[model samples]
Target chain A: MKYISEYRDRQVIDRLAGQIASFRDTKAVFMEVCGTHTMSIHRFDIPSLLPAGLRLLSGPGCPVCVTPVGYMDHAIALARQGKHIIATFGDLVRVPGSTSTLEKARAEGADVRTVYSITEALELARTHPGRKVIFLAIGFETTAPATAAGVLQAQKEQLRNFCILSAHKVMPPALEMLASEGVKIDGYLCPGHVSVITGEEIYRFIPRKYGVGCVIAGFEPADILLAILLLLKQVTDGKPRVENAYKRAVRKEGNPKAREMMESVFRPVDTEWRGLGMVKKSGLVLREEFASMDAAGQIRVMVEPPVEPQGCICGQILKGIAAPSDCPLFGKMCHPGNPVGACMVSSEGTCQNAFKFQSDG
Target chain B: MDELIMMAHGSGGKKMHELIRNLFVKYFRNPFLESGGDAAVVPPEPGHIAFTTDSYVVDPLFFPGGDIGKLAVSGTINDLAVSGAAPRYISAGFIIEEGFPVKDLESVVRSMAGTAKQAGVQIVAGDTKVVNKGKCDRLFVNTSGVGIISEKHTHIATADHVKAGDQVIISGYVGDHGMAVLSQREGFPVKTGLKSDCTPLNDLIGKVLERFDHVHFMRDPTRGGVATALCELAEGRQFGVLIKEPAIPVREEVMGLSEMFGFDPLYVPCEGRVLIVADQSVSQGILHTLHGHPDGENAAVIGEITTGNWGKVVLETIAGGRRIIHMLTGEQLPRIC
Candidate 1:
């Protein structure tokens, strides 16, 4: 890979590691805000190699882990009804709802699926016109364009049978909530793919007001190390700034067209985060302009106040105060094959990342 | 004979024969080919035989560059090529639905014939069975090919042949076929500018094989990208594969779509591209020759085989990061979410 390989020089890693060892600032908690980075760190066993005292705490990075209890309940409710086939990404199916997860509902004969793209849900609706194919939409900005595309596509095809129960959330508001939570964060590692579309501008709020250094980085070890080094410089110098370590892909302004598409389709709305309380304007709602594509808009959703299973601290886990292992059900009750929380369901989730890579969780 | 097998035609009998004779044989007539024995006895040859089978269920059966028919034949032949073989003959099997249009079938068959001709292979035999509608996804075609492995060092093992410094070479562009299929399927069809690179690489592989005696192993990164292919090649050898993401060839649209879909193009399937493992010391001349060939024009040394935790593949991403590639346990694209 052109811009990719030269930076992965092992000699560079050793040199950088040596440089970091020379400084040896152990008290700072370098929080990686992106779930991808959290998983990447564990998958590569990065923490073990880091100099002692440089703690890497996972922020509320996993979008799936942050998905509130109500969303899963609503999806499972729709799935169990058997009238509509609930199509969603792999993340949602295993997340525990109030009664059961979508996987359980599916085994009990609900037409639940783990789709790769929202467009695939449109295809299912197109193929099986008789069935109401509702998509269980979730994710941050990077994944929103596809759902937005699905809405436009459904409208174009006049797919009355297809609709979306949206739970897509935005990142900036969530980051603000994290900063508000008083989580000890000396720096922030931004998501690469998200930054590519969102640019590095929206994240300026975090460093300016909060005094935490933020680096928009690619999800690579070298990229991560560079972001950490930048954060370290900020911490040591007592200066707060936003830097772009992944400039090859991410631009300063991000992809305006994609952002426009997303904004045009979805509006900022108050949404419930599983562990994090309902952060205002964190969720994406179908714009009144595209209300017809929204399942929430089309039908009278008599959803009860969302409830969670007893003792599942998915919300606390999302805030980085507790790890997945800290939860009583981490492995015993919340295995990937059987999940008790939404966090354990998605691969990009904190719990799933912990389960798959950080088994200590 | 008896006005014969309708779709009841293929319910296991002579009626099926009549249907085949009238609809299929009438179009695909060949003098040396017939399909009625326990197994067709092919001519014996001195060189080892390279055999491969692929079951294609690609939707939008007819896409920009190819259809299910072309996909079946071309895919199997490509597999043979990656095995250091000169593809010779292919046998196609179609699990078609009953209500399928004769015109559609004609177009598909004609396409298969054209693709077979382009690959320099003959469809020597075939079997057809039609199930009821709503059962099959349009038409599912499975093809198996037999080719002559003429390379003297044909006893290739991805693990056995690879060393710490062995170079990784890709035949050409990656993710073309996967992205092309995705574009049309999602209804955001952009005039279908892309074509499936569903061409056979038998001759191209033969060319590389002739000049390079140190060519360790070759594989078409079909369903699992170069990452999975390398993982398989590195099996039992306890060696790791290091890939430079920038060196991996991916088209702009593919790169954009990958970003949109949150997928690694390296894990997405491709039917045309091949990954070659060769000692890095001996790779310059092979890469030059590959660069000359039209099919391998975009070829580049994406990575190198290394002696490390064997059977592991490390992708040194463009962002100056590394990710150890895991063989995806399941298919790339699922129904929907």
Candidate 2:
């Protein structure tokens, strides 16, 4: 609690809040592009601290929320085959596919395991050599390096039974698409963990081409407040530029070794997002050298046609054009227990966070 | 003698008799159990009584601070304690998988007897069943307890007397038992030296009830934790509960591990702690009594019942912000990041 509690100091947060509240009035709408940021914002009840003119919107940052239903069907297809073990992040197991979820499949006797890291998935393969183990690799750049490292470890060990179903995505392409699609936004609060790997420099293009302010932020209350204050200052001064508010973790150049490792194992390709359809060079797949370790190339299964849930406006919510409350099925038919969309499944999802932490007061 | 539990052990044959005499009786010897009857015939008590039962199926039967046996006994006793009763007798049942180590079974039974004796409760009756391999986990335990409560303390059990301005007091820290079990299961190899707070709270609760006259309600924050318990207390009620975030006590290790796993300590479980709601005037006296007990040394006033925000539990965050704490919907999953 040393580093964490210090950042949550009441006096420091109050002083920063007072500064933001007293700053010159500017009508600005900033979007935070990370699921953790969305959770932190609500957990701290940050909306009450901001000025009436300033608004913050959630972006397509949750990897679980962005993963397409087709990918889920493909994974379920593999699980139903009874020849492979599906290892995935815990939240993905509850995501509803075209027909069923991985959780339901598991309840009916499929070998689906939730792991904290890819290393545990590889370990399963090492122990259960007779069965194929597929790691459902899904995340932004913050998690890609670990998946890349896992693939390399598998190759070095010549793990014939281990492979990965890569749904990994990069942040820049999604941001580029959001900006080019003409979504209204005055600034962006970049993800802290992703920025730690991709560095603050990757966001330079946003301010250069679109003239939007970008600030890399940590997930603490003080860190988020400071980022918002900086963005307000940028909007008031009419100087749109990239800034690093989370100096403790993020660097300008980022971690070179992790980026190199990811590049060596994966190559960029256009992929489908649940809400935002195919963006150019947004997805990562295993390179030709590691093709044997790719589950998509190693296994084939029959998948039904993907179908979207009826009256679910998750697509509009992800594009930041609609609030979760704007959807017809917001709380009536889309509660967390019986989630109709991916956004209601993951804890970091905008709707789920709002449902769990938001108050009428 | 066979070094493992075989199918014949559950067949009620000579092996079963030998097991009863060699393990269960050796550890759980009492006048009622020595009769070898089908049920425990307890002496009649002359007051209102509390009866409760609980089942334990925790993975890795043996954890940092306690094992399945200790947990089974402590859980049942705590249930009766929170009802403002003095636990007097308990019954244990075991469903074990075939081929389990005889030494492990012996140790589990021994632990149960040890915990029962320490709490001054007699293990009056018991049953054991063995299933085939893979039919069950290594072991499972169920315990039922009975206790007596005086007429003066009976009002504390129904919780209808709770009113506005009643203070909420919690015993010690939260999330210790939950974090301990999770870390052991994940094999995180974290050197936090974390351990479960799995112990009986009957003595602590009994002392406070004896000293305080305005005690209105009591509950052990078990599976769903303090947050869920508070939510349940506020649901369908005429008033609400407002808790201060910083007032909730949490250990550094629990906080750190929860942060690493993307879990909130508020939603995690606590096995050995109690949450008491009482009148505002006697709150200082109750806190003084709780702090004098070993299990309640870190007691603090966390919140109070309120009139506004009916049927909702709101938290005043570390910063000057507030949010509602809802009942936990499902198992909290580890985050992708």
Candidate 3:
């Protein structure tokens, strides 16, 4: 815990809190574009230490929360076919599809399993040679590289039974969409893990085009408080720039090997986000060379048109226009145990994080 | 073929009798079980007795610190000990899958015998059954225990005497047992030197109970970790509990692994730890006594009960902020990053 404990030091955190409070009179709103950041902000109770004028909004950073309903419907349709084994992240098991969820599909005799990584799914394909294994590949750039590696591994092994249902997305195009939509925002608290792979330079366009301050932050209390302090300084000085506050893990050049792996297997395609609709070149699909490893190309199933749940404002919440509390079904009809919306499903989703960790009576 | 267990071993024939005599009775030898009756008959006790049961189905059967056998016995003993009783007798039942190695089964039985002997508890009765392959996870153990509660220690069970100004104490590091098992699970990539804190806590609890009459409540933080245990304690109550985040004791490996997996150490399980609620006057004395024992060497006062915020458990975060501790509603899933 050497590196982690220092970041969580009480003395350092209290001093940063004091410094953040010194700019209490300044008015600004900063958006954090990562699900892990949203979870950390609430887990550390960072908002309690911040000034009232300085507000933090959760953006569409949670990949599970941003995935469109049609995507889940297709996955469920494949699960119902009873010929393939569906491997997915744990949170996706509970995410509600149009008609049923993967959890329900599993209980009713679907071969669905939760894996910690894509490597585990690949191992399943290696062992269960008789059954086809489909990995539900969904996440930001931080996880896309691993899926890409899984694809390359399958190709090398000639594992025809393994394929990926890719729903991977990039961060920069989504940020551009947010700016183009003219959402109110002063600055952005860039994601730490995603920035580690894509590098700090990818966010330079935000400052040049929109004149908004950007600070890449780590997922600790002191790191976030320091990021807020830096953003406040930028707003006061009227100088907007993409600064790397989490230099310990994030580099300006980013991780080249991971980017290379991702580029080899996937190509950009316009995809649908739950709230943001379709953004050009935002999603990743398997390239033509690796098309045989794509689940969509190998399997064909009929799925009904997707339907959104009624009285669910997850769309507005993911867009950072409203809070989870603004929804009427937040705590009453929806909860972590029986989530009614996608935002309430994943532990990192804004609504789920707020419901589980936020200190409100 | 005889090296592995077969269905005939549970058929109540020659194989069944041979397994019972060679495996179970050889290790868990006791007078009550030697009688070979349908029920264990013991002398009548004068004091109130506590009865508790637990089931152990942990995956990977054996890990760095302990196995399912150790977990089953320790879990039952801790349950009775936390209720302010001296655990005296236990009954073990096993449902093992067919084709399991006989040597592995003997190793688990030996572990159980060793742990029970160290705790001075008798395994008075037993039963075994073998199912088809894949019916059970390799094995499952269920243990029921009986313990006698002295008159003076009965107050710990009711917890009615607990009031404001009382202190909360945790015996040792949290999340060791959980992370130890998690790091060694089948599909995980990381391997570490972490060991599970899976040991009997009866000696530690008995010492503290004998020395302090003001110990109002005691509970083992097993599943759902410290946060869930504390939340259950404060639920539907007239008082609130406030705990300092930095004061809680956690190991470096546990903290590191939990951070790596995106799991919170506060919500993981600790097998060999106890949470005590005692009056302010005897809080220091209890800590002093707990620290003297090897199991309680890292004991510390973590929090105190307050007169406000009815039924709420609040934590003073490391950053000088506060958050409510809610009961764990679902499994703690590893984040997708």
Please give the lDDT score for candidate 1. Answer: 0.76
After superposition, which runs of candidate 2 have C-alpha atoms over 4 Å from their true positions?
B186-191, B333-337
State which candidate has the highest TM-score: 2
Candidate 1's TM-score: 0.76
Q: Could you give candidate 3's per-residue lDDT for residues B82-155 as a string of tens digits?
A: 99999999999999899999899999999999999989899999999999999997888899999999988888
User: Where is model 1 more than 4 Å wrong at Cα?
Assistant: A1-27, A32-56, A85-182, A189-234, A239-272, A277-317, A321-347, A350-361, B1-19, B26-29, B34-39, B157-159, B189-192, B334-337
For candidate 2, give the lDDT of residue B181: 78
lDDT of 3 by residue, A1-361 (tens): 6677788998999899899889989999999999989998998899998888999999999999999989999999999999899999988998999989998999999999889899999999999999999999999999999999999999999999999999999999989888778888889999999999999889999989998899999998989999999999999999999999999999899999999999999999999988888989999999999988888998999987999999999999988999999999998899998898999998889999888886732
Best-performing candidate as measured by DockQ: 2
Q: Comparing candidate 1 with candidate 3, which one achieves the higher DockQ? A: 3
Which candidate order results from sorting by TM-score in descending order?
Answer: 2, 3, 1
- Arrange candidates by DockQ, highest first: which order? 2, 3, 1
| Candidate 1 per-residue C-alpha lDDT over A1-361 given as tens digits, one digit per residue, 9 for 90 to 100 | 4554455556676666666665575568877767788766765556644667787877777777787778777788777778898888766666766767787888998988767788778889999999889998888888898888889889989988999999898888888888877987788888887898899899998888898888888865677777777778788889889899999889999999999989889999898877778889989999897777787777655555677877787777778788787999887877766667767676666776666554111
Which whole-number lDDT from 0 to 100 does residue A122 have in model 3?
92
Candidate 2 chain A: 10-residue stretch with minimal lDDT = A352-361
Candidate 3 docking class: medium
Residue B139 error for model 2, in Å? 0.5
* TM agreement with the true structure for every prediction: 0.76, 0.98, 0.97
| 2 or 3, greater by TM-score | 2
State residue A253's C-alpha deviation in candidate 1, in Å.
12
